[model samples]
Target: MADDKYYTLAEGCPFANNASAVLMRGKQGSGLGLLQDTQLIETLAHFSRERIPERVVHAKAVGSYGEFEATRDCSDFTSASFLNKVGKKTPVLQRVSTVGPESGSADTSRDVHGWAMKFYTDEGNQDFVFNNTPVFFIRDPLKFPSLNRSHKRHPQTHLPDANMFWDFHVGNPEGIHQLLILFSDRGTPKSVRYMHSYSGHTYKFTKPDGSFKYAKIHVKTQQGVENLSSQEATRIAGEDPDFMIRDMFEAIERGEYPTWNIYVQLMSPEEAENYKWNIFDMTKVWSHTEFPLQQIGRLTMNRNPQNYFADIEQAAFSPSTMVPGIAASADPVLQARLFAYPDAARYRLGVNYQQLPTNAAKAQVYCPFQRDGAMRFDDNYGGDPNYVGSWIKPTKFYQDAKGIRASALALHTDHEKWVGEVSAYTSEITDDDFVQPAALWEVLGRVSGQQDRVIENLVGSLTGVKYPELRRAVYSLFGRVNNNLGFMLQERTEAVIKTVQN
Candidate 1:
């Protein structure tokens, strides 16, 4: 093969034909000028056109090659080919990134970390686009753009604005649950491998008979969840911007592969209907006490990327990427992301993005209808009829046979109406919204000084609010979760502001 011997162009043309510019020989043997340099022109042109668009979110990332092995049999609830049998191993490409930061931004920023992994199962690809936090800021998909923009710079100042951050959250108090966690010590994770990942949206695990159970996946780091304090995070951001990335790379290089145990909190369809909290809400979590975790699999990241751009940069993941027996829930954010992620990939990586090696499925794909986009390298299904229901060339639909099987009554009740109810459900913020945050606060209290650290972390940012009224509103927001906690926040925040002014 040409690959084993020497270098070649994108076409199989050998590179020895044109290593340097074709030129007239000078006295000192320094080639004078280029007369014919097709390879030179090609190399320069390819280099110029090499860079594609960066991701809108999670631009700065470090990826690894891993494997997920099923530890338990889940065929009773899910018929997914990856999970049906015990000890089944599926190859995975995982990427960990920080949101709201540019590619050049510091890795230790106090921002939400994106946890994305692609599983190459026999059925197809299953992409889990998850986050470090179990809950999100809002359940409404429409507020997504505004919510992200607010976390970014101000329009006029072109700088991170505290007022803008507080304003957005105060206006949409529905995000309070996420905001509380965001301002806590958990916001600044020490390393990507040290932090846990959670699927904020509930998904479904369906059996062949269309019987299904709601599932929320949690990947707990075997290294254990560890975070840097506010001071430590700030210091690391300045000293080593790529601290987290470098740590992960070195760990793999040193043969210290990190692993996470994947568990799922599952609820039956009847239990979901009777549950106190809406199962579809992205802002709330199913309590551990109510729905305990059941172990499913384990993931170990043993290999680092050989080429960053090809392995990590070109990789695209979406919650919509599902195999048989695995499906998305009606969570508005998850539903929106199901469309938004692939749409962004199409815009950035071309319509044939899925054909890219990093994003391609290991399983055989026979879709003739989706063809002829830019950068398409396939043979366009080899003269098969693109139109469906063709008598001339009878096309086989392999996908239909792999999807969830159903009985007559199961199709109408759980399959049809359940989807309708989940999609039509609307979420609102009430006093009940504070329930989880209150529980979280109690959990922090058990750690003894953890709550104090969270208050201190929050006050440091809250005190930077330029407007007094804005600061008060922020205090009131926290106070609603706990009366004494709110009072402490106001007192400490005011004291910090006064000292800074003096």
Candidate 2:
């Protein structure tokens, strides 16, 4: 070990030739030395334990610190203190990620984009874990894990199987809405700064007295929605896997801060009852015409994190972590996620994951009973009882807003029957599913070479499907979207695969 050159136990050393130390001779038993054996064991030990557990989903991401300032008053919908006054500003930690991909996957991969934000409001932390797409693959929570698993590498093959991905979508036809969005150019965002974000899940804006209005949030990027073609995305993936991550870091460093216009779509409880589609359904979007977006605020990412792992990797967010004015909806997918997210953080980090610096709230969090777990950095609620129901120590409200008023509520009748069973109920392919997709197809056609590229990109995936039935199901699904699209896709796939084999 030299002073100038760092010491290596043969384990951490950057050796030019590791195999040179091994004893190889015709008559090794004559003069074998044990000194040469120690180096091999040390090298093997270090290599074995290098990896940690990967995230279940949304592993590939880029994050930033930003400020959200209210542009107008939204007091009618919710008594949330943050939105009560004009020009109110709150610090936000935003993370954008690609869903269903490994941490090493390309930023421009064809996948659903995540836009998870944690607002450090005065009341507490408000988490908005949303996707770039307005709608989701499935409305039911039961379909979630399966949907993610299908997108992941196949258990047996250890490869991304096309059959698995298409099977899940075709079987759960409700995914048709999101599947269309996925195949579109929007799937491959040009840059993290150039893409828009959305609050796909319907949340409620409530008042102090427990009354609320259903709302959906949108964060449109000021830079505009820019996308890379499939060829460009593939080239960048090969050239620079961390292209989007590096782009954001350099942009912020150069003081070209990215900003988003925040908008909300509000609907009263009375209106939801008569709405055409289920308001609680994550797969369905509230018609923009019916529930127009209203300007609310602006979010600008001005600062970069000092440390990537501490600030980004350790950050945890959940839709359940709502403040006074913001609350969860009865949406089945959202309701299920409320429990799943925090539980995931607990398992991934620890029971007291929130105690971590990035996840911790600015507001005082006093829960004595939840003390003393692995990595419990804080004092275990000194001199206080671990169990609840102590007469002397009464529980206190999380926030106290004197002037904040509760929202007006519509009449409520006990309709417990609506709370239905969770089953494998696929979506019916009505004409409605194709309407938006058709409009999108026309837009693609407007762009030179885009229609041909769309077909080429889709066929590249479709041709890899091993199962004939699954392939036809996919063709049939697209056929419902447009007869011409179905025929073109089938013809293109067959021809491309044939050329490769020949």
Candidate 3:
């Protein structure tokens, strides 16, 4: 007999009958099934092992399938094949996230947002793991753990403590530039589409001839920047914690795709040597006037991920993953992340995490030397030599004379510098640190009530600090930002504290 409907099991098997549908029971209406019950055991086993570990940071993120089209020729800067010709479209998956907060936290939190993108090109995967802001908190690699710890919940309380966050910020005054931007409305972006992504770390874009240019990337949304007020963000956090994610998904679903104009600010090696601000400093911004952005491409998120778990959650991106032309700079933070991100991914996923569908590269990856790890799904370079120095097989590298010369030139650098005392990394507030914040404070005054709101916000958080010394140090840091501003926080915070005490 023919089947009325498509005959199928949960796994799409053409099952003729689902036998043993009736539950076997004893006289008292209670029974224990034997090992014969295969379906129940199979279902439970599959469900138990479905999830992989979520990312420690950028855990709550939304991703979409898109295309990055080169809008202008940039052959002079880099030889990246994706950017070789104008109008070249490369498939891209972009994920935007709120850092620090867990996967379940509100999307509208006032925090640094992660803007990571993975480009699937013919060459390989080029991951642009960046931030929404153009600068970051700390520059030193050693301070990374401490910086993340400060942003995270306190160990003892296990609660989001403002004191820990502020104390770290005050102590690490190199973060002043980023701190000013973070507390501003930019932190509370109304939607992902309205936000901009910045390659805060300087990267090297090399030519086929081994010549390279230091380039900073910027992605300005065509949607234009939009922000949420503190009150709006608070209300939205309560009403709809997943507001940003839902907004992005629905917008794409409705065919209202968001696009960003991608541009790069380039600096020659010669100019980098004499640049006023340390090019490697994550806290400092490269002057736009000095190195203006040259339009290179446009990125548009046209489709959302079909399955969040498969496409978004399992996706891995690392700054260390680069194509031939793109390379990392000597920026300490970038150097740290080059190692840290991949290490974290391996821990969160597995040692063979790159074998996963979302993280796998499209380009020809011939790394037989890196074969045979746990969960290695690939052929394991079948019958091939896994180690180096094999007489039977030889390794081939497509290196030109220029590449070899460049390697020699790099090794010849006489960059001798004194190594000082190594201690836990920290930044003491100085005059140079306050110069930017003071300017930002004046700029805030131009926006009606913004300056007052900033001061009020500063005072509210400052009063919560438990240590008197730390509190005074914070005030001193702000005092350097602006003496009047410091006095205001001191006076206002004291009054508020006294009221609470009474």
lDDT of each: 0.87, 0.81, 0.82
lDDT of 3 by residue, 1-502 (tens): 4656765557776655555433479899867775655665666678998877777778888789899999887777777889989999999998999999899999998888999999998888999999999989888878877888888899998998878998888778888778777877787899899999999999988876667888899999999999898789889999999999999999999999999999999999889889887788777778789999888999999988988877888788999988778888888789889999889988988888888887788876666668887888878878654555445323322223213112321222222244689777554545766666677889878988876776776776777877778877877777887898778878898888889889
Candidate rank order under lDDT:
1, 3, 2
Deviation (Å) of 28 in candidate 1:
11
| TM-score for all models, in order of appearance | 0.90, 0.83, 0.89
Alpha-carbon runs more than 4 Å astray in model 2: 1-52, 390-432, 442-449
Candidate 2 structure quality by residue, lDDT tens digits, 1-502: 5556644564475554546455544564444335566666676766795444556899989999989999989888776767877899999999999988899898888889899999988777889899999989888788899999999899998999998999888887777767767777877889888888778888888775656788999999999989998889999999999999999999999999999999999988888888877788777777789899998999999899998778888888998898777777888789999999998888877788898888889876666668887888888777654655345533222113223222233223232245668877554557776666666677778878777777777897898897878888888888777788888988888787779879
Give the runs in model 1 whose Cα sits over 4 Å from its true position. Answer: 1-36, 390-414, 418-427
Ranking by TM-score: 1, 3, 2
lDDT (Cα, 0-100) at 53 in candidate 1: 91
The better-scoring model by lDDT among 1 and 2 is 1
Judging by lDDT against the true structure, name the best candidate: 1
| Tens-digit lDDT track of model 1 for 1-502 | 5347777777867777556676788788887666366677778889999988999888898799989999999988887879877899999999999988888889898898999999999888999999999999989888889898888888998998888888999888888888878878789999988999999999998876768899999999999889998899999999999999899999999999999999999999899889999888888899898899999999999999999999999999999898878888777688899999999999988899999999999997767779897999978777665766555434434334445223232232255363333355455579999998988888878876888998998888887689999888988988999998899999998988899899
Give stretches of model 3 more than 4 Å off: 1-23, 28-30, 389-429
Please name the candidate that would achieve the greatest TM-score relative to the true structure.
Answer: 1
Q: Between candidates 2 and 3, name the one with more favorable lDDT.
A: 3
